[model samples]
Target: MGVDAARGLSVIGMTMVHVGPNSAEGLGGAIYGFPHGRASVLFVLVAGIGAALLSRTDERRWDARLRLFWIAALFLLIGLGLQSLDHGVAVILQHYTAFYLLALLLIPASPSLLFGLGIATALVGPIAYFVLRRLLSDVVERETVGWGDGLGDVLAGLVLTGPYPVLVWGAIVIWGMWIGRQKLTYASVQWILIASGIVVAISAEAISWLALGQYGRPDDSTDWRNLLIADGHSQMPLWLISSIGSATALVGIGLAIGRRWPSAIWPLAALGQVALTYYIAHLVALHFLEDRLRFSDVRHAAPSAMMLAVLGIGFAIAWRRYLRRGPVEWIMARPFDRHRRREASQNPRP
Candidate 1:
């Protein structure tokens, strides 16, 4: 439930980043700036935690793969459909599908092993990204979103680049599994999550500052090599580290929200419960009803964001009162084996 709340918050953060003009100025800018990469990372990391939890259940092993594949297909297919809408948003469900496919082999591993591998990936993967992208410059530049873009580009986008590159993003999932293995309900564990998160995030940014200097900009010589320390430049080692820290912080804070403020948490948690439904609908709304919703412009997006937040909160609370799952979720699970679809065997509303 707490994780659900966390996911809801993460999606809300994404809403701000997507709608706003990437502000770097005032209160609106602050909202847009802080959650840009941070929220997306948290979303993926929470997904990892959710997957780990599902794998720990007694359900048939094949059932998990079947369910994941089905979900992945749905996300990819729908994401392509959303792309046709041309709402100017870079949809992430395509990358998420790739992540799920990757997780099939990973869901069974021990938490310690996952955490260790996550650390290793963080250390090595970004350097690999820089080297690989430059080596495969032409292939890397090809469009991976639309069909007929060629298989090489699609694979690269999934494994090496994009809105969320799976190689580095996979590490977040791995660490999330480690987090899932812990007794998150325990206050001590929660605080430890907060503590370790801060250490890693700060370390990444500090290293970046030391290497690049406060005002140093990305140059031809430094851009590729400096990935070792560059923050805000997605897929870099430093950025990955800091994002992991922020993701963990969100998990800790989410649990705290669940434990302390049940009343306030209810609406957000409800929204979390229907996340896929809301997420997809958000894009649809932004596409067809952008003007009606009055968030068509990035410069004036905060108001629309606020409005959608309130509406989603209220709608989720109301909808969940009557149905256990959102429409999209229920549809996704309908084809699964009956036993696997049981509430006990399912992943939470990710």
Candidate 2:
């Protein structure tokens, strides 16, 4: 329920970032902009946690791992098909698939190793990404992920230049795996996570402010100094630190809320459980509504975002009363279910 609650928040956050007053001035901007980048970060982190939980089995691990790879392939195909629609949104499913694949390597690692790798990546990955961008400046042809985009462009976007670079963003997923391994049912763990998150977030922000204050924020985006700013989507080390901290805090809060008042978060839990279905559904909605609405303008976008969120929550709640799995989720699980049944048939209990 806690994981679902956090996932629900991430889903809502994505909606706000996609269709709300993200760049509007004053309170609206502050409200809407809060989810920018962080929502996706949280979403990916939740995925990692889910992966960890999925692989927690005493049976042969290969089957579970194989299932994950299959799902990744599924995501890649669906993401590509969605991108072909040329919807105004940058589809993240492809990048999400990439994360799933990378996580396979660390799924069996110890919690300490996972934590160490996550921290190391958080510190070093951004620098390497920036360096590679400079090195590949003239090599890889930059293009957005969309239909008709060259294969090379799509691959590059998934790994490096896209809005969510796996190199740096992968750290969040690794940290999430670490968190997932912990005894989350304990109040001590939850409070510790909350404290750690608060400390990391504040420290990163404070350092960023001091560094940018002394060196000054650069107007030229190419300036190395820009890396000191911890704005969302900046893809800088500081931003990664801050976002990871924020994601950790969110998960902790969700867990606390869920354990304390499951009833209060029931609607969100329902929405979260069917997040994948809603994610694609909302994009489909946007595709159709694009002609009627100007999502670029916050005035129209904000209300539309709220309306979609309300509808999604209501639909999810209503759907849960009758169905356990969502439409898309059920489809995704079919192959695995069949595989398990086949194994059971072939190797019946002795």
Candidate 3:
């Protein structure tokens, strides 16, 4: 159930990210900003919570860890394959897999240790990056390589090109795991997270404004530095802090709102349940639309709205009727089947 919620948030975020601007001026634009980024963070945090939950289920911790390692490898391979087709190296699932592999070793530690690690990563990772960038900016620019060159370069780029977000993201996961272990219900956590979220959200935004700057009203061909340094779009440092703060608030709000009217968000949740499917599907669909259908000339607003509506409706319908796991998720779950079967068979020993 928690996994479903996380997946739902991911799908919604991916859709908005891919679609860019939409027709509706107010709601759609806001979704594209802090909300979209926050959704991605929530997805990662919940992933940590799910991982911790899974670790507690059985005694074969080594086998479980191996399974996760392979799954991460698979995601990395998929990302490589997609990049080969010139799809760009922003494949987040690959990053998730990589983080999960790293987190597996840390999963067994005490909550305080995990939390401490989270705080350390969140604080220290960016400082290290800034220092490295100051020293290596010229060299890094001189190399000037894309991620698709090879596995080693891709791995290296993954580490060097923006490891801070992943570090903070991993921290969120650890934090979620710590939260998940508690004996609170969804409702109770919602209120607590909401109140805390607001405080964090304000702090994050303030830090973002101080570190970066505010958006200078939307326009075509906005300056790259402005975008990079702007409140919602900045990277590392301010980006990590602000996004985390906003994400905390949003998750709290989502849970609170979800409790009040579950049905209102049933569609969003449904879309989330089949997130991997929807994510890959969106990429493929966009490729076809732009490359084959020749919609490359179309404006961002109309096409984005159309695609968002189509994806939302399609996923909601699929979730309402389907009983099986999403195709990609099912493929990812294959490593667990052997253990599940062994457990099942052991339960009724002959």
- Give all candidates' CA lDDT scores: 0.76, 0.82, 0.58
Number of backbone clashes in candidate 1 = 0
Instruction: Give lDDT tens digits, candidate 2, residues 146-216.
Output: 66778887778888887777888889889988888888888888888888998998899999999999999
Off by over 4 Å in 1: 58-60, 142-144, 220-222, 228-233, 291-299, 337-350
Evaluate model 2: give its lDDT.
Answer: 0.82
TM-score winner: 2
TM-score, structure 3 vs. true: 0.78
Better of 1 and 3 by lDDT: 1
Name the lDDT value of residue 152 in candidate 1.
71
Instruction: Highest lDDT: give the candidate number.
Output: 2
lDDT of 1 by residue, 1-350 (tens): 77898889888887877676554676756655677778778888888887777677656556777777888788778776776775677778878788788777787778778878988988787777777677776554424374554677667777776656777777877787778878888988888888888888888778887767654656652255557554453677888889989789878877877788778777878988898888888888888876655443455787778778888888898899998988898898787647646765667676
Q: Could you tell me the C-alpha RMSD of candidate 3 in Å? A: 5.1
For each candidate in turn, the TM-score is: 0.89, 0.93, 0.78
